[model samples]
Target: MNFLPITKQEMLERGIEQPDFVYVIGDAYVDHPSFGPAIISRLLESRGYSVCMLPQPDWKRKESVQEFGEPRLGFLVSAGNMDSMVNHYTVGKKRRRTDAYSPGGISGLRPDRAAVVYSNLIRQTYKKTPIILGGIEASLRRMAHYDYWSDQVRASVLMDSGGDLISYGMGEHSVLAIAEALAAGIPVNEITYIPGTVYRTKEMDSVYQGVCLPDYQEICRSKEAYARSVALQYENTDPVTGKTLIESYGTKGCIVQNPPAAPLTIQEMDDIYDLPYMRTYHPSYEKMGKIPAIEEIKFSLTSNRGCFGGCSFCALTFHQGRQVQVRSHASILREAENCRRDPEFKGYIHDVGGPTADFRHPSCEKQLSKGVCTNRQCLFPKPCGNLKADHEDYLQLLRKLRELPGIKKVFIRSGIRFDYVTADKDPRFLEEVAMYHVSGQLRVAPEHVSKPVLDAMGKPGHEVYLSFLKQFQTANRKAGKKQYAVPYFMSSHPGCTMKDAVKLAEYVRDLGFMPEQVQDFYPTPATISTCMYYTGLDPRTMKKIYVPRDPREKEMQRALIQYRDPKNYELVKKALELAGRRDLIGYGPKCLIKPGKGEQVSPGMQKKSRKKTIRNVHKKKGR
Candidate 1:
């Protein structure tokens, strides 16, 4: 139940000399299952391997990584829970002011491209140590892909980080195999047979029956080739049908990705979460103020892993895969009881779902054995005919939690696929959510109202969202509650046009509400949308798609979402003119904004504008 050793003295106190693994991470060490480093380290500890955490080591000083000295087995490196670049910079490529993962919500604790930087730092001291890369940064960048910040395609992280092996995806199975092999004195070069791992080698002679991707130079030379390679990598993500993939780097070597590890069994998922976790940030961080990241998740329970929703913007398909894996109700309840007993318990459970809440089982029965379809999706384009949209198991789980004596509220904040809800025949799940789970507001992502934009984002059409809203409102009425649906929308996604932006703004104007925050489409690595952003070609269809890359256009599109705000007036006005929608500029009932001083407008329209403005101001004062 103790934290892993972090220093030579702590290692000695634990009666260990040189430990089995030095887990060098890019975050302040938080011993919680929610953090990947904690899960991996605790899993290793449970398997009788000594692990010393090196959280946020000074990358500028090689001696910082020497605190725990060289490990008996190897050094495990990760760029914390998030990709370091994503954490440090906004989607606008502007530097962010705070890092939730760092101590006191401070930025600059971890270096950019942290996995590579930390791995290189370790090499400066322990040149021959078996460095294994894990976590989201290394996992997503395991192969050659586009780097948004660098504005070019980059080589595989395994090549740049100089890591001997990459345990991609949920790494428990591959990591254990790696530890056993290393303990048996197998060299890292010889440990290439493990599933869910990527490695480099000069000898391609041993790579049997593997798919050879376009050479790295070819992809770098051709964006279309890169798109093709992305599609190939995506198809090989399932454990049952996925094949070993090889990416050549000319003479340096070939990077080989073994097929993904099999999804964990229910019992195995239970065992992993049941491992001893202090479930909080390291006590040393107390003086620096609580880690902001923990506040959201401290009371939350992760009931599932993997997603079947198949979101194009999400990197889950590349990391966790599309196969849904869940923990048994008994296991989830055990964790809930632990939370109930905690001193910080407030009779509330923040969340009780994973990638997509309410996905308690695989998308279909066959997925358990045959894996998801390589070329098709379970919930997008339209739900597959075989898609099982049943919510009975999830409903029962929620009901059981509500019946718990000490639990006052059980909420689902991780978001659910509303289209999936609509697909289910039974109406009880939606009814229960509106009645009990929702805390007056249910946040749903309907990304955009434009049909083309929706198709590009792989999200359901606007009509589906509208139907869900009607159903949700009906359920709220039945429960005698005035609940609201807070729809989340994104702007500047690939395939989004100026006209499409206007269409979304009109939809908002009709609703008489403006979203406080808007998400500009961020082109992180390895996502289908990111590929489209960089290549201007849909990786799925290899068709050319319109991408709004100009900074001014991006801002204008964002402004349209909050057109009601005074600050966005000029941008919105300019956007309306550019889209040939100046008709929406005057004081018609459908108009988004009124004309400024000295602007030409009909006398009738001017009178209406004055009346509307007066009503709006009165409404504000009443509030």
Candidate 2:
């Protein structure tokens, strides 16, 4: 475990002993404090168990297990940053250029390496330690999934990793139950009755079924079904192994829907905000002056949860449920105060926003009845009329925070739903957000310029992004502020093709704004887009379309976004030629290639030609 504050030697030297019952091993971005594993670990600690948190353990190393010295390391918990399965898809089989895990070569020590290393280490040292794998990685991929890297479906991580149990979605209740049972000397296999857990049968040849929840099968059949359920349903089988899923039926798998945002009690918000955090830099006294990157910090407080925009590529509504869960304004203020007081405080707060920072509450008051309200435009394909739209309270909350004494600046870094911001009947909120909250660049995911791709991704439309861009620019100009909208575009999404990518590249070029940051669609387990990417269309809608499933093509399409870069010119050319979209050449000022020119050779060829030309020119000069 590579911990920041306390060195392994320091823990050993101080004679700090391992806890008696639990050992948690997982990935954590310090900023995401309310994320699954961290929240679950805190819940367990609150229950009075001896818990050891090994944050972001280096599971690739065999020696990483030494962090837990050996006090009967009862149970191992596995939940990495996002879904481990999704992380596997990005790197496990297909090579990714921007993949953080494997940048240069296909490193064999990934995907299952974390699970294998931890399980093998514990088995060798602890002999009979119980290991449980959960989180999106394990849950959605708990059964065999289409292994893009392997080009074949493989068994779920639970079966492949050889763990004792795999708990799926929001494991707070399930983990606590498991911990209580373990403390009482309950056998691991007997705890199969627990909901949101997946485990192999006693024979280790098959899976066993647990209590089934409602509408589970419907959600897994297709993206539309999952969307209809708002991703609160779970349905999937191992794509390769075809093994029968044996976990509790209808148990929303391990997708933990967040508590609703509306009607938030002040006390609950206080409890969440007041939680202790190491806010300051732990490395050195001198390094304390500099703030850590947004990626490096421990503990992030979610001001709200749940989204209504319902983009197809997103899983928030399904995971957190459409109902918004907001912490009280005062509670957020207290949390900020606590973070500032921490010895780790570097005088900076990462971000204070969620799903859509502007739309802070359920779109309608009908949320009190759990009835669908359809006031706002249905962001999803089948827009629900029951959806409400409100940003007033959220705006007030933002204003209150700016007045906080210790806070230097509060950032709305979480990607905002721009359509909602523009839809806000009140311009004051947008004005304040532009003037006070924005850190110069606001990230808005317009996703695509093509209407079909936008529709598939559940975005409003390309025009909406353009409209928002105009409004944002106008707002900035009115305020004498030069803030820009950093539109987040996705390549190779389910309904997107090479042509779509080129069109988007042209659109961005036309806007005279080239985004350095672009997101390649990563099909994680249970995301609607992931399902569509693999199966080609919504299984329920039966709408057929072209999907760029080939990893090479996906890469080329992604590179086309940076067409102006000389290095990426060939990639853009290849992408355009491959898509038969050469007509778009020189469409905008950013387009590097000239019209009617022969397709330039590869960079290698160009380099060789340049050398030959230079040598011949030198020879002529010598003569």
Candidate 3:
């Protein structure tokens, strides 16, 4: 069977041979290896199960199910990166823009496009197949998350999808456990004791309980909290048994499990790079001259896992851990060689990075021998004095890749921690990195401009990001290169009010950059900010303050950063007016929103009207 695309025809062809286990449904990007579904499949296969990876089957179509043959056991796993709740908005409303590109059709709604397509097909082809649902898309949405898409709190994926169980968090261990028990003839309803698994009660009245109550009051009580706290809170609860193994107050109970600690040795990391990848679209799509999105075109190579940079909005440190684990240099070089053989080789290596590209090896050499280091760099906002601060080894690896025969240019497309770059003892190393590794634009995530917000987000001060930008500019001028730093900014993050967003907009305007793109904070399940958003207090330090939970207010605050757009004038105006800051309007480059003179219409309002007209025109044409 075709492992990548499980088309209907292939399912019919496989009908003659019944597999020992079948992964019923869900989504997966063809490129992600470390993703949940892929990892679960690998683990089950290791246990001697003849598993079939049915990625993103068309669950909406009945014909799609008739293709896949019946199996001994059915498994349903989602694309691990996303939460299924996102689907309810995307699918239920038939919101085209959100649903078309979604991993799961319309966040967490029944007949989820992907699940419905696959489940319908299975029911038509095979009767009474036991289906299981797992992954971030299924896991976080396993409980009600404030669904911005639908603007309402919805039930967990188990309730919505009608799946046997909803497994949350890093699922390697839980998936293996479930497959083993099923293979041993255990009933699905009796397997609620497992960690990271969520199932309904026998009567379907409430979720079951296996573990003790988590300290929700403590964890969710704080106004400003870390992402780790939120993730830990959910992972700690076993929804099937309704027990909380990990304790914290104000936090919701969830089935929590740590990512396997058996760090992929450097050699293992290197070997993974050597695996073959499909670098181009299939022939059928290519013949029609259709190019895939950049995410689809780029060949992704993860040099390491986890991160020490505890950026609040980011879940990397929580999900992957702060300790850096690397693959061998030989393994990376092997992968580069393989890419050269592909027909689509363009001489440009997309990205060679992990959570933090400059951080190589663990923070300390003793971590491997000592079985985990308690270095405070991974925990607190303050930099550790004794922390290992060197990039010489990582720099050498980049140089070696440049020397390879097939590779023409290597770019560090993954984000670089500017503070780490400034901390490096070797000035020459920084010079070499700027000169050799950069493509046209180097992307650096400064996140926000306000000091309080940056601190709350667990990032270095604004000056550090500015210092690196200056140094990068100087280096580019000296080398006669035209490369520029692409500063990524986020608006409406925790602690960011209209004032903070305006400050960020001023900073952007002073830098003479009118950013066309900006990120509005997305509070996923198990994120610290999400709890703060819901509870109005930081979980770490029970401080209470106002959080902009209203979606419209958040969108308006985000719009302030793009003041140059006449289209945003009204949004900026409303945001500033609501915040009672009228002085910023009608003056300076930062002023995108023209202030209303007591009663006249604003430029932003006009733009909105125009947009509405265009949208109505399209509606009339049925385009």
Stretches off by above 4 angstroms in model 3 are 1-16, 24-49, 58-66, 79-81, 84-132, 139-147, 150-211, 214-262, 267-297, 365-380, 578-580, 586-623
Candidate 2 segments exceeding 4 Å error: 1-18, 26-37, 55-73, 83-113, 124-128, 184-186, 192-196, 199-273, 280-300, 317-319, 342-348, 364-378, 574-582, 586-592, 596-623
Candidate 1, residues 466-536, lDDT tens digits: the string is 99999999999999999999989899999999999999999999888998778999999889999999999
- For TM-score, the strongest prediction is 1
Question: Against the true structure, what is every candidate's RMSD?
Answer: 2.8, 8.8, 9.4
TM-score of 2: 0.74
Report how far off residue 45 is in candidate 2 (Å).
2.1
What would the C-alpha RMSD of candidate 1 be, to one decimal place? 2.8
What lDDT tens digits, residue by residue, belong to model 3 across residues 1-623? Answer: 12433444454465536565566444333433535554555556556776665544555665554444666766464643444444443322343343322232333322343442444456565556666776556655544344445544444455555566655555555676777778888987677666656665533223333233333343333323332344444343222212333222222233322223344556655544443334432233334333323243245556777676766666554355555777777777777777777676777787788778777876666555643433234433645664677888888889988998877788886777888777666666667766888767788888888987886677888888888887887788766789888888887777887888888877887878787668777665545566666666655555764577676887787788887787777888888788776656653334555555565545765566478778889999999
Deviating ranges (above 4 Å) for candidate 1:
602-623
lDDT of 3 at 580: 71
For model 3, what is the C-alpha lDDT against the true structure? Answer: 0.59
Q: What is the lDDT of residue 605 in candidate 1?
A: 80
